[model samples]
Target: MSTTPVSEPMAIDSRSGSAAIIATEPAAQNSNHSCRDADLISKYDVSGPRYTSYPTALQFSETYTEATYRQQAQVNLKQGIAPVSLYVHVPFCQNICYYCACNKIVTADRSVARTYLDYLHKEISLQSELVGKYRPVTQLHLGGGTPTFFDGAELTELMHLLASHYNLSDSEQREYSIEIDPRTVTQDSLALLKGLGFNRLSLGVQDFDEQVQRAINRRQSVAMIKTLTETARLYQFKSVSYDLIYGLPLQTPASLAETLATVIDLSPDRIAFYNYAHLPQRFSSQRAIDRLDLPSAQQKIAMLALIAEQLTAAGYRHIGMDHFVKPQDELARAQQAGKLQRNFQGYSTSLAQDLVGLGVSSISSLHASYAQNERDLDAYYQRLDRGELPISKGVELTVDDQIRRQIIVQLICNLQLSIASIEKQFAIHFSEYFSQELLALQLIENDGLLSCEGDKVIIHERGRPMLRNICMCFDRYLPQGATASFSQTL
Candidate 1:
């Protein structure tokens, strides 16, 4: 591991002392990326795609078919590509949470999941045949409506099927992660997961306060989280991450401050402080939430400020965007090494260039294109039953798309963009190719968010908080009209 301390440039905040600036170096390792410009945050906190993918999933279309994905797979196999990542989505949830935007099937019927599991295995087999059976998988993530919603035997069968068809890496160093709902999994169930080869666990604990939990209809207790975390540690899971959302209903500064204090005390390996995007029109479950109960934009910003202060004070490294980690965690390590990657699965330490997404609404990102399984479970099963890949939509990258992707990835993941590197990779004069963009970025530059030297564009401390705004300066496909489809960046 590289011991060279990282020097991240950051904006200073008066509220949090020096920990508000420059979240870099071992001494300041727990410092926040301290830009506290609420005015700027509010001004630039417009709806935008998270850019987990450069083009974003908004560009995926039905035009790019299963044949296109198959061709890409064949090309990958012929070239003897590196080990790929696998993302399996389990869309079954026993109940719905009001804040959820994920594609899910909510039901009381346990039998529904059994059928879904059978189809998931079939889809896995079909993908293996195209991508070549037993190709090494360096990273595997089981995400869901709730992955632990299935019984132990179902999960065991799922893993067995994966092992049988895919070259599942047994190396302890490889990442095998699963998302678990604390309300669903017990200590024995966690043990079952550890036995089945999952080493990383992400627990969904939106809030521990009973009021907030009740408002969101996810009534998990603080004790539930405490016990589950302790159990995960007992099993020696490599990493345990807790997920929290800031801008939800009933999230007052005092309430959230208490929540953060409790979370910090627990001291999970990683934390994701998400800004809840309340789009009732887009996600039906959200409609059930009373709009009047939702926090105002100003309150949301305050909640974010509290998050920055509390987490940084508790000695957590603000990795990027809404993610934080212990200074020694792989995510922090990856950030220091410039090897961190942003994908549909958020930040990943995996070096694999290709990711095969299995199950409903999952997305597979190839070298030159992106594919998504059908969002509707019935449609997804219908296609698989017909012995066809369930790729309902996708998009192939254009040359310009590829260039923009490289630039955006470097800037978002590392907080800096080397003009020469982009120029060399894309074979274009940086200034010449992005002349209009540079002209537009004068707005950001003038606002003290970033600085553009002769050969590099460096995100200034003030710009760190509005990283999305800085990244948006390079998005060529951003719609000029209304932006209701995306979430607020702050």
Candidate 2:
């Protein structure tokens, strides 16, 4: 129940009025540490989408009309090649956290949530019309501004609306999941979630240290989180994941290590150790944090190394960047078997063909294109009220976009890419078709970040920590001087 705020150093630029920039001293000038050079960071930290989708959401064009999205949905439904995965964004939080960068609005109005729910149901009906009849849903994820912000009745109503239209088969058990705020959940809430068929829960436990918690304006305790975990398990939650952050205000190696040790004791099936990307410009609430109270670059790197070492020692397998799982967890197994896939949601075990996103500001992906709903809440509701799909922008990927995406996904998910395999599958010679991208890889290889053996380009273990940098080689839409769109790759 401790609510004391933790103080930190001043390396983060809080007044930048843009994404908060955490300044890090360039690594020591040595051949082995060349990857940390200023030139390398400057070159790789360019503005590009995180590639959750092939044509990244930023690349989505205004030309994607409602008709286009409906047409695409019809074709995919007719093909019946893969089960659909649905993501619903609930963007209302009772209070704002200084460190939160997610697209959310702070409000205590229950009526707002209720009205949003009604519009969500309308959007669901709109989507159903496009796909026609029921298609078995394989996955359903409810994300942000605290999905539990709505009561159990609202959650059940939303799920029932989806199930009624999509038709979940008995044999096709859905991977129903939701993100829970530790400060918000109660016994009744947990019971309602279980009754509504939510089998997975992801709790946001940034840090257990009271000082750090206060610094970020997110106050919670180890005891409360432990109780929440126990409650979820008691309610038959199949998988529980905890989200942890590194390099936050008032964070130190010892403090973070102690937090991780305690988290391991809770024994959640998965952990996401995300780096604190201090972007105040993109998120105004972050402006409340003092920039002087952040960690140094060297400290940040050490903290990351420490987290990896401790998690690995605790028998958790590192599944690419920022995620770890127990050996029995499906994510780890998928990584080992090369079945891992990345989407708008960081990493996924389900191999659903298309992602249909509902709610304001959500994005969806299909075989040939990517589309995003309008980000403005009023705009989203207006479109739905007008009997529209709320689709504001999208991109139709070319054949080249598809091929490059395949290569990028393999590198990001598996840390290995075979040029010959890519060539054979796409019917294009890698060296000839992607000359510039290959040249970029050569620069990375020369720096010891990657290596080429025969026709395969493999990222070294050291390089694996910087997977985003490696993937930047193939991005076709990297804009010049657009450095503020994404968080740091470190």
Candidate 3:
């Protein structure tokens, strides 16, 4: 890692003591002069899933039904397992960010949000009826298209409706989290959210540079973010996180470095430095961005290295794959204890029995299967109006799917896989069951990305930056020649 000189230390106020600050220098020029000779960018920039979930969302089929989902929920609940987590996806955003590929609907109709909330409540009740009343909810997350798009009262009602059915206790052990757009949040909104039991806030601060923000069509000033962070802290939010992206349009090394310098001064508990993936054909919004404004592959790589160096020097732990957290944050602690987990929400400290998702385009996971709600709002409401569950498509995991999912999750979350543990748990010889995957991993091992000792495969630190590439070796459903179907691994 490269080092940058700090002229002075800046102090940022925190609930605990002050946060340390360190200056960051502009990214050094890429040293890979031979990349052009071998066409390395084209070779390694193949389409791939981010592996947020094993068997990626693409594998979800139309064969599974609502009844199957209910059955699975009941069985899991009856096993007296730990409480499950809940994720509510509010898909409406007022404006479009060109770089975002998340499932979202851009609309300004407030009535649509209201109608959607009604259906969301019904779905919560349906799942509650199946899982029984006493099943405690250990974690609850409200994700976007800007979850804060709803007004204060609307948000409060949604929280109350879910809390009523799921029995959320006012305990610190339970993590209640939400995503917010800094441009949309208000002091009242933050207070309302805090009162409704949301203890964590993740502000979308993709790039502080004005030109970069304009290129992505997401314009929010650094002062706006600072005010929002200050207000969230005043409301006593347990943790504050910021999301930053490299490789976006108009993001030169100097501009991104300046943005990082400003961000470190704010001292969020967690930071996610993500890669901007441009897939115009799949995501129409991205087509609006001028490709010429974007950074090159080498520049993107340099920016990532710069972020790692600056953040590490400022006392943040690189908690694996695109996430950094202060040493005192629960995520960092969980990582140290080997209890960190990765879900659709990125890194988390919660280990719930399962995840129950509500609303259109939401996804749920039980031990036996994974189910998804209807993707279209019209279809979702029609199902609920007919007194039916809103699930349109899902996949019932076979015994093999379950075993493979466990292995993938372990590798992605913990960076280590034990073949013996998998065999003992699933009652199958690891080599016989995963012969093809092992062969693919061997190829990656030859490339110095991983090490295989006996039946165990460990991803080295060098491989950590390319964790997604390693995970793809085990993805069974990735269609052959699916070049334009997914995003870049970097």
Candidate 4:
């Protein structure tokens, strides 16, 4: 009875308040990092941090109080403000997907959204004031139970609120995106998002199989998504991405092959292929899913292979872990230039170093720390009412944390890490500083997961799925078996 460790969709996985899980390379030259390497993968397929940050969300602490967050923000403000990114969390959802692990609200009361947005506006003003009202916003994301849950007017108002408070970028190069639940949006909604200055759309298309949709309680027709993708293209939305998950109830590799067939037919500009993390205890909605119908770990591996092979064959580039993009996509080009990055939003171009997360449970990575707002709605509103930033917990990066972060981000984003470069930048001998991490890498290196040359460690294409396991060696905070608390890295 081999079980796959559960992994949350990177969408809200950061809980730090980024939106959308980003991911790719060109069509002409296939990296062939495809499904053929599943055998090697099964051996290293274990649970570990996604490494969206070096010290992941698990390291956030109450000791780093709201005051600490404010202090950091003020420090950065005085040191010379940097351009920033924004992630707004919309916690409402009209329905529940049994396998979902995001922080979301289930309600038919549309009025609740109006109330949430009102509080969010207050948060925007407070955060902008602290983070710097005139800082250029080079990137923006709207993540949620479903960002589209807000009516067109409400969505418009939300954008206006952000624009009025912060320096919103109207440049053609700014990466503005929002997550869309097909069930919650229409062509008008897409039009509205573009008019609001969002150039990207992330569609939640978990799996189109009728049986899979019923089991997960998220049903949307292929016709619906096709229409939206077409409309997004027609409207010239810079990029349209789809979110697809594997290892759900009743999913077979063959079924996913069919799903990919349809997915390829529609051909989204980018796709986030995630594994379904089935932890019933943590996410109550998952308790609604019966464990028996879930795919075996091995089956899930095969499904991973199927996705890689098919998408690559269709001329999509396998860029980072779980993301495939067409050759011409900006993300692919960014990866080639070693500028792709991962945050709460998963994979993205490194548009800005500081990000401000607004709304309850949204996480902000700024002021040399990662700060999270109150997790629940009540505490969020309570803090805002008191005229305070709703930040509840966070971690400031130490020199070691920053060093380790650079190493991890380089490997995950650029597919290779320059040991010499790291040593030079940090002014430390790599071998002496990470002596134990290097010794531990013996097993990983022998397994052909990566290679250690004079001053470089290269992650082989086939070894990409095992990235979490490799990175765990450098994690100071990850105790043995602590991975049980995280989603698996299949």
Q: Which is the leading candidate under lDDT?
A: 4
RMSD of each: 6.3, 6.7, 7.7, 4.2
The number of residue pairs in model 3 that clash at the backbone is 0
Worst 10 residues of 3 by lDDT: 1-10
Clashing pairs in 1: 10-461, 11-461
Q: On residues 1-490, what C-alpha lDDT tens digit does candidate 2 reach at each position?
A: 1100000111121100000001111122122443345555455543333445555555667999887887788778786636777778898888878887676778988899899999999998888766643666777778866788888778888888888878654442467778888788886788888777778788888888999999999898888989989998888888888888888998999998899899889989888777676777766878988878888666676677777778877888777666788989887777777677766555776757787888887777765888888888999999988988899988888898988788888887777787887888989978899899889888888877778778888776556557777777787766453335666766
Q: lDDT of candidate 3?
A: 0.72
Candidate 2, 418: how far from true, in Å?
2.5
Candidate 3 deviant stretches above 4 angstroms = 1-43, 479-483
Q: After superposition, how far is residue 7 of candidate 3 from its true place, in Å?
A: 44
- What 10-residue stretch in candidate 4 is worst by lDDT? 1-10
Could you tell which candidate, 2 or 3, scores higher by TM-score? 2
TM-score of 1: 0.92
Clashing pairs counted in every model: 2, 12, 0, 8
- Residue-level lDDT of model 3, residues 1-490, one tens digit each, is 0000000010000000000001111112322322232344455556676665556556677878887887787788676746777888888888988876666788988898888888888888888877655767877778766687788888989988987888786889878888888878788888988889999888888889998888888889888989989999998999888878888898988898899899899999888877777777666888998889889877776677778767877778776667778889987767666567766656777757577878777778776777888877899999999889887777787787778777777776667787888988899988888888899898878766578887678876545556767777776666565434566765
Models ranked on TM-score: 4, 1, 2, 3
Instruction: Give the TM-score (vs. native) of candidate 3.
Output: 0.89
Judged by lDDT against the true structure, how good is candidate 4?
0.79
Q: How big is the positional error of residue 255 in model 4, measured in Å on the Cα after superposition?
A: 0.4
For model 1, the stretches where C-alpha displacement exceeds 4 angstroms are: 1-38, 480-482
